[model samples]
Target: MSKHGFFQITQKLFLRDGDKFLVMRDRKSGLGDLPGGRMDEDEFFEDWYLSIKREIREELGANIEIEVNPKPFLIHKHRVNEGNHPCVIIGYHAKLIKGKIEMSDEHDFMEWVDVKKYDPTPLFTEYMLDAVRVYLKEYA
Candidate 1:
């Protein structure tokens, strides 16, 4: 293994409500992102579900209950801008099981988008666009 040993692992949720999917504009980056974050140091890789739930609770709200699919539909590897560190993003399909959306400071705006009609190019990164394409072709 290289000195860097491991890549940062991030879990993203494709939270769908009928025909639309949730998208949020990050407060810091000013870029659109899916609802999720990097796995914490204390989190076990095997317990991705719990990590995802925790991320959702933190980024969205603790009152929200999202049913995340354990299997990831998309995975992408890239270097994050923050530290020029290699990262792996795992995307999963999810549904809103309960509660209302209460935005956290992490995001500035939230919207439900119909991928078929919306162009993600302006708001998201290429890797995120790749996930959107996969979602449209296979899952949507």
Candidate 2:
């Protein structure tokens, strides 16, 4: 059987402290991941943007505005989150439009880690970080 591909949606949250991006830690996975999820069937990208925005709000409790295909990262990739479903993560540069972050059940916590500080860990797949590395060099 051909592998069923789910439409993965993710928002890249970026706040430049001079020149770095804000990355989040998924509490369930204990790994660094951007804010995103799968697109409901037939959901348009613009509508999906709001879905992503709402998700991040509920998770981090911050007002964020996201633009689709907003500077694509080499980060559009997948990882195994659940044994059954592949996580399709997309990266986008986001500006913090409002508020402070308070973690919800989804993530252990959050941080404004520097881009240069990213290191691949057991929790976070190397493919994801590899995307970050590609974005850094390609965009820089």
Candidate 3:
């Protein structure tokens, strides 16, 4: 909603650990999700990378160490909640530099999924699976 208008902008990271990437289970939806969220209103003024870092810290914990590629690997636009709200999600590639993953309240579980052997689950949305495939094609 910044100067950009009505659509909400979200940033998601494919946090890599070797051939695997991290995914979390949303507490509410029971869906597999990535490790980022909507950008805060104030964050619109700062660099997008900072917003991404902040989201990772908030979701995965402040002490978690990781390195994110500044360049985004995927961009997707979709409607949220039965098409009531529109969103644009930007996805990036990152690597776990150190520290074990700790879950935040928003998510109940976390797993490192091997991209090469990934199988689609009902817990993942099509775009989520597509994002993984995109990562495999370009980054992995």
Best by TM-score: 1
TM-score each candidate. 0.88, 0.70, 0.86
lDDT of 3: 0.80
Error of 3 at 100 (Å): 1.5
Looking at model 2, residue 87 earns an lDDT score of: 58
TM-score of 1: 0.88
Count clashing pairs, candidate 3: 0
Backbone N/Cα/C clashes per model: 0, 2, 0
List where candidate 3 sits over 4 angstroms from the true fold. 1-5, 81-84
Tens digit per residue, CA lDDT, model 2, 1-140: 89866644544544444455666677767776666555555565465566666666677666544334555544465665655455566666655655666667877755565566554354356656776667656654
On TM-score, the stronger of 2 and 3 is 3
> Candidate 3 residues 1-140, lDDT tens each?
55755987889988889988787887876777889988888999899988998888789988789999898878987444334468788988889999976678989988887777776465577666676567767765
For model 1, residues 16-79, the per-residue Cα lDDT tens digits are 8878889898788787788998888889646778888888888889888788889987898755
List residue ranges in candidate 1 displaced over 4 A: 1-5
Misplaced by over 4 Å in model 2 are 1-11, 14-18, 42-46, 62-71, 120-123
Which prediction has the highest lDDT against the true structure? 1
What's the lDDT for candidate 1?
A: 0.82
